[model samples]
Every structure is written in C-alpha cells, then in structure tokens.
Target: MCARSSLIAVIAALACTLPAAAQEPVKIGALLSISGPFASPSKDMLDGMQLALDHRDNKMGGRAATLILRDDQAKPELAVEAANRLIRGDRVDFITGAGLSNIMMAVYRPITSTETFLIGTNSGPAPVAGKDCSPYFISASWQNDQPAEVMGEYLTKKGVDDVFILAPNYQAGKDLLAGFKRTFKGKISGEVYTPLSQTDFSAEISRVRAANPKAVFVFYPGAWGVQWVKQYSQAGLQKKIPLYSSFTLDEVSIQAIGDASLGMFATAHWVGDINNPTNAKFVKDFRAKYGRAPSAYAAQGYDSIQLIGAAADALKGDLSDKNKIKAALREAKYSSVRGPYSYNTNNFPIQDFYLTNVEKRGDELVLNTVSKAVEKAKDVYAAECPMK
Candidate 1:
C-alpha cells in the first residue's frame, strides 16, 4: 500500500478505538527549525508528520486538523517570535515542533505558559523532564539523553573504557554527556564542548588522537553530524578509534557522509530496520513514497501526529481543555510505530533505545538497528520530577 493509505488506516483505526467525540477544527501550532544546519532533517520530520495527517484525511476525533507552522530558522529569538505568533496570532490549541533542544527551550515557556498543550516531536530537554517538568509538556520523542545512555551501556558491555566526549555547547549537549557519564564508568579522556555551528573539528580531532581514548562519543545532529563524521574520516581517525554517537548519524545524513560514516555506531529510539508489524508498514510505505529510508527523526515526526490525533479523538477534538488534552497524551491512546510507549509520571516517554551501525543497503549507506541496547528504559531524572 502507499504510505498515504497505510497511515490513513492506522490513524483511522486509532480514531475508531477511542470513544467517539466531536468538535471544531483542531489548530496545531508547529515551531520548527526549518533552516540553517538542521534544514534537511527538519524537512524530513515535517514531511513525516504531514504524511500521517494526509493519510488520516487531516481529521482527528471527527474534527479537522489545521497545522500552523512557523520557522525558527535555528535561532532563539526567532523561536520566541514564532511561539508568540502561534500563541497570540493564531491562538493554536496544541503546540508541537521546535526540533532542536535549544529552540524548544526558548519556545516552551511562551507556548506552555499560556496552558496550550505541547507535544515534543524532538528535543526532550533534561530539566523539562526532571525538575522543570510540566503537566502540559509531553514528549512524543525521547528524553534527549536516553540514546547516549544506551550507547554508554553498549560501550560498557563491549569492555571499552576511557572515551572522549564531543558535542555542541548547549543544554542538550550537556544533558547528553551527563547521561553518558551516568551509565559509563570509564574515564573521560577529553570532554570537549565546541561552539554551536562552528564546523571546524580539526583541533578536536587532534586532541582526540593525542588523548587516544578507547572511543569517541559525539552528539551532533543534521549537517553538523555529517561534517564531523566526514572530517573524522579525513583525519583518518575513524579507522583507528571507533566513533560512537547519539542522533548524529542516520539515513538522512548517511548517504551524504557516505564512506566516512561506514561502520559508525550510534544510538536512537527508532532506526530504519526493525522487525515489527507497525515498523514494517512504516518502512515499506515511507520508502515507496519518499524513495529513501526514514530516519529516526522522521519516525518521531510521524509518531507525534499519531499521538496528537489519538489524544484529540479521545478528548473529542476539543483541546481547549488543556488539562484534558494533557491527560489524553499521558494515556497515549495511539499505537506508536516504535511499539508500546506510555508517559512516565514526568510526562516523558519511557521507551526502548537501540544500537545501530552505518552499513550499505544497496548503493546507500544507512544506519541499521542491529541490537537492542536498552529495553523499555526509563530515565533516572524521572525521580527528580515533582509532577508526579
């Protein structure tokens, strides 16, 4: 079946499972980092979210869904501006997107402070899931650091110690390294936080080689990820020191990075290959529709709409009762493509994480899920959350 028909069937099935309800058009405010370094990945995610909506006939809970999107341009000020536009100008019922953790942090307060339900398709910041948890903020994605934790666990199982950590200097990067540290007992040879979008990793590579750690763990996304892997290969570091990353290498960038990313290992909640019925349908349909494999970001984007649709149906499309919508999200009335998932008391999803390796699938180099690193893992920060 086409991706359209398959998604329609899945989302329609979800609507049928929920108690019937009716209301006016549901307005969704999406704040996305649609340009700059993350442009390609963000577009993939947007397409994935839109594809699900298209298949479902753009209706949820018998009410039409109207998604109003604003581009953050990968800037904090622009993110705030977009949040204000969606909140004050469009008066959206639910807010989604802000693909990057930094952008999400900028927009979250402005959107959620007004009590509009926000579902994170990506960017599950640590504090938001911990001490700063909110009843209305639900993450349909991951808790930012779970992948790193999974990688850490994998590294430990492999008997590797003394690794180097590299990431952009931001809250998400800090959270990622912290999570890795939590699981990894090895010594940290070099913990380097580079400036945002600074592309030059020559110095960092030099330090990594000099330090000669057992492994290198990085947390760069989108174009940043591609550049790092390519440069690492150019520096001839990939062949000597195994590079591990979280959300840094995937289908979207694998082909771009090509030989550089071959054998590169990364961790993510969803990968292109998973032997599940839901994922089978998603992979086949996405490939048929887009002529390429779906990245984890694409899966997250698809799941976000599935979640919102399910919750809206249960709440009868009247998302004005932000608390009720929040309750629906917490219940997770929809069947996620990644399989079973429910919100922890902190309103972040407790999901599985996996290990993937970049390998050639035909002419394309892709990140394939090869092992389950953490099964039904829950973040430790859940205890820090007072929301429960």
Candidate 2:
C-alpha cells in the first residue's frame, strides 16, 4: 500500500513539473554586427525581428518568448565568441542574425553542431548552401550569390554585352562574382577584387573608365557601398557606365548615398513595394515602429522570427524535441514578407527575385520593383547540397 501511494505521489509531482517546464520562455539569441560597417542594416534587421516578436505579444505558442542580442562587431572571432556564450552560457534554443558572410561562416559550426537552431537572418555564404550544409542550419534571407545571379540574367536579357565587375575580396564577394559569371555570357571588360577595408575607390573608378565597359556591375555592401556609389557619381561615371549592382543599393545605403542612388539598378528578393498583405502589414507597422522604411535585411530578420514562431507554434512550444522542431521548421508554412517562401533541398530559401530601380516617391527615395527578374528561383549551390 505504501509503495502504491509513493508511486502515485511521484507521478503527480512529475505532472506538475512538466507543465511548468513547458511554459518556460523560448529563448532566442541573435548574434549581429550591431556596430562596424554593417550597423545600419543590422539595426534594421533587429527592428524587424522585434516587430515580429511584438506581433506575437512576446509569446510563442502560448509561452513567453525572450530575445537576447549580442553584437559581433563584424568580426569573425568576435562572432564565434558571442555565439559560444549565447549557446553555452545563455542556453538559447535558437540562434539568428550574422550580418556578414564571414561572421556567419565563423559561428555556423558552433551553433548548428549543438541542438540550437541557427536561422540566419542575413549573409548566406556559398559553403553553407553547398557541401557544408547542415540540417540544423536554415537561411531566412538568401544565398549570397542569388541577387547577383538575378542581375546577371537581367543584364543579359537587356543585351548588355561588355561589363566590368568589382567586389570586395572576401567569401561573399567571390561567390557573387562567380554567380554573375555563371549567368552573364558576355565579354568581360575587367574584373577587380578590392580589399575589404578599402574605403576609397578612385583607383577602381579610374580603371572602370579606362575599360569603359558598356555597363558596370559591382557588389559592395553597407558603408562600402555608400562610398563606392558616391565615388562612382563624383567621378562622373554613373551616367556613362550605367552602374548596376547587387546588395549595393539598399534602403539603408540609399539613405546615405542620397541623390547618388537615383536611377541606379539592383537586384533583391524583397523591395519595399512588393504587393502582398503580409508585406503591407510589415511595412506599415515597421514604419510606424521604426519611423523609416525597412530594408531587405529587415525583411529577412522579420521572416526569421516568424519562421521560429511558426515552428514553435506547430510543436505547441515544446522545444525539447529537436527533431520535431527541425521538421516543423522544414514545413515553413508561415506567411512570408517575400511571398511563396520555402526551403530548397539544402534548406536555403527558394523564392522570387526582383529587379529594382531607385525612384523618388514624394520626398523620400525608395527602391521600386521594376519587374520580376526570376520567378521561383533556386540557388545554384543547392545541387551540391547533400541534404534532400
């Protein structure tokens, strides 16, 4: 009789503890380059993520949700250290945000090797989308090469035969230029890889003028982009060369570049003017909250949080089962700001790309979607990914 009574008491105690454990806050850690070159886009990304969380009332599947942010200062070493602290110290269930490809590459293994899910908000390097792909890693943004690929195709269709290309000498830079060459079957006037720390591009501009390609394509992000665009304009090459780029003329950079961004063309997965109910709400609320239009990076950050929330909701907030969480994430049923979002074989996004031109809408300049460049585009690296 005493044994039976003790068993019943133990079972009852276990039941009471289970409910409390299930109700524990879902902890999400974000490792971002909140300072350094990527600061503006990173801030936009964070604000978007926060807006998504706010929409959920800071809860996921009836349980409280908490976000812990860490700045990586745009350095690989710093990103790794912060990722380790977030995983080992804070014990975050999800790890998101790495504003640069180098930062993402540095922290990918550390976060994904553990049970924590690494939903990258920005920066999808080639390795992560290819042979190095992990089931634990998912990209809420895009492959690094995708936007460049879109521009390459767009320019090819437009019959621009001779082009000069330039980018920073880094992993993403190499990937982007490679992607452009993959689709752009044209005479290359010149290809230049500049130093990542290069703030001055007068020499490169001089070289572009010497080559005098029919058009110029470049990939320079963040402050680097602002400097390059300003230099390109100041050099009087913007009109002559028909400057085209990827990830170079975003909302954040355009604000800094001001008039220089006008008439420039770029490719992106999401622009401010994408016509969708989800995007409309996102833009409206984001403008209300942040008092400025959100960038592509911001849209990606918003999607990452929404993806996590959708998975958590599917599992009813019980994140103890890693496999179930991964499966739920793979489903990807949430309404995306970028319409029709889903994972490719490698867990990278398979979505549409847009060709955008900067135009003035009233007093502010914005990227208006000129046309759909590619419908339901898949990254070139997906074939190399072992995962189905």
Candidate 3:
C-alpha cells in the first residue's frame, strides 16, 4: 500500500478500537486546516497526535480519548464555526489544534464565553499570550513571539544591527515583528507590513535592498514562506544578505522551496537533530511508517497527545472528571518529547529554543540544530503579564 493509504489505514484501525469498558470516553476537538496551505503542517500535527494516541494504546488515562476533528480550510470564519460545532454539537470537553492565529482568535470569544478550556496546538498570537489570556486557555505552543526572541538574541549577540523586518500585515505578523524588535537592541532599518495574500514581493525586495540592512527577518509560513523565500532567492539577495526568521523556513517550506531553501536560518523549539532516546523512537517510527521525515510541528502535535495521555493517567483515566484532568495538566509532570515542559502563568510553553538550519539529512529535508537549548527561553511579555 501507498504511504498515505497505509497511514490512513493505521489511524482508521486505531480509531476503531475500544480501550476498556470501565473508563468514560474523553472527547478532544482538533481544528486543523487540512485542505489549504497549512495542509502539510496540519497533517503533520495530526499524524503526531495519532502517533501519540497509538502509543497510549489508543486511550488516555485508561479512558478512550476520542478526537472530534474539523478542517478549518485556513479560514477564520470556518474555524469559528467549527469550534462552535465542536463545543455545542460534539460537546467536547476541551478544544485544541489551530494552525493559524486568526483562527485561534476567532474561536477564543466563543470558547471563553462557553467556559471551555482551549489548548492551542500551534498558533501563538500576542494577545492570547498577553491581555486576552484566560484562565481556561492554555497555549501548548510557545507565545507568538517566544521563538523569535531567540532569533533576536542570536542576531544581537552576533552584532548584526541595521536589520529590516518583514511580516504579513496581520496580528501574528505584527507580534512577530514586535518580538524581533523587543530583544534585537539594535537599529531596525525599517519595518514593512505586507498584505497577507500579496504574492509578488518584488517591491518589498527593492525597498529592502535600498535600505541595505545587514540582515532581513521575515515570518511567512507555509505557502507564503515558500513564495517569499523563492522570490528572495530569485532577487539574488541570498548571497548578498542574511535572512533570518522563525516560521519562514521549515521542513515543509524546504520541500516547497527545494534547493532554494539551503542555508536559511530559523529558530525552533524542536529540531530533528535532537539525538535523544525519546525523540529517536519518534523519528524512527515516523520514518518507518511514512518514508518521510516529520517536521517539528508534527513532533509538537504528537507530544500534545502524549501529554494528554499522561494527564489521563494521572487522573486515573476519568475523562468525565474535567477538574481532575485540568489539575493533572497543570501539574505538568509528563515526560515530554521536548524534554520536560511546564505551563507558564499564561499557560504558554516555558522551554528552550535552538537555532536551526535547513539542510538535507540523507534524502530528507530536516531542521538541524546548530545550537543547544537556550535554557528557559521566556517570552518578553512574561513580566508584563498580570497573572504573576
């Protein structure tokens, strides 16, 4: 059988089994953009979640943990609708997995109003990590700005000043630029906000070239990242200037940009280069099953399910007891794939960051860690958060 079909069969077979008759089934909602630009990462995350579910013997805390999945199609309105459906129709105990920040924000009000706990699978916009943070909302991912903070610090330490910032003119984009600016501590040549769907970056490239910044930072993810990196390379600026970003480059983007993505720098929490026992099993199993290397997004998605299973175990698999589950999650004693991670006051991740490079690992494109964990890479708004 083909890889996709094989994967589907595996997940479908896993989905069919019952854990035990004793424990209540816990419903967890997953909203991912399965048919749009984020399809790859979204699928990557789903695959990870599936792997974790499989590893847990398809149960959480001895209870059968069921996933209520909806494809948002990368649209905010669709995401809101899906979230509402998950909450009202499916009656899920908790909601999780959003690939885009706009989608996450769209679901926020409804989720918060309904008093449901929403755990972020990915999207880490500033407000959700700051002023809009809620007691029930937990961002399993880092704050929107946290990963970029490492990039900023790296650039600063390298004495690279006079940098140009580029980001989509959206909330997350602004948050990314804000993050880079927060710790950069140098002369920002300019900050250019481009339209989210603006395809041609020729004008922006010309402007950036005119500014002659030492380095250029951008935060375009998925297809946008692919196009931007390709255009940046075509503009002949790759050899002339340094390009640094967080989400702008990754395994998926590397596949999109092909040889053009070589040598680009990105910062991430997890990289495939992590040669640890926990990650080794994950990497081996993923490769053996799919014949392709998994991305960090997949790693995180898988870890979230594993963490959920740990919570279930702690709660003794009582899926109906929401309070116990919440307490178990808060205790955060799980052996995470990204090492041990605990929730911050805002429920965002408090973990390490590694400077990664997009490179070929055998026949696969993977993020290789050049730097070890920059211990306790905290978000800048931690001090600003009222929770403390």
Best by lDDT: 2
Candidate 2 overall lDDT versus native: 0.91
- Per-residue CA lDDT of model 1 for 26-110, tens digit only, reads 7888788898988878887887788778867999977888788888999999999988888888977778888888998887877
Comparing 1 with 3 on TM-score, the higher-scoring candidate is 1
- Rank ordering of all candidates by lDDT, starting from the highest: 2, 1, 3
Q: Return the lDDT, model 1, position 253.
A: 89
Q: Candidate 1: minimum summed lDDT over ten consecutive residues — where?
A: 17-26
- Please list the C-alpha lDDT of all candidates, in the order they appear: 0.85, 0.91, 0.80
lDDT of 1 at 236: 89
Q: Which pairs clash in model 3?
A: 48-302, 61-312, 61-313, 61-317
* Model 2, residue 127: C-alpha shift (Å): 1.0
Q: Report clashes for each candidate as comma-separated counts.
A: 0, 0, 4
Residue 333, candidate 3: alpha-carbon lDDT:
66
Which is superior by lDDT, 1 or 2?
A: 2
Task: Quote the lDDT for 287 in model 1.
Answer: 86
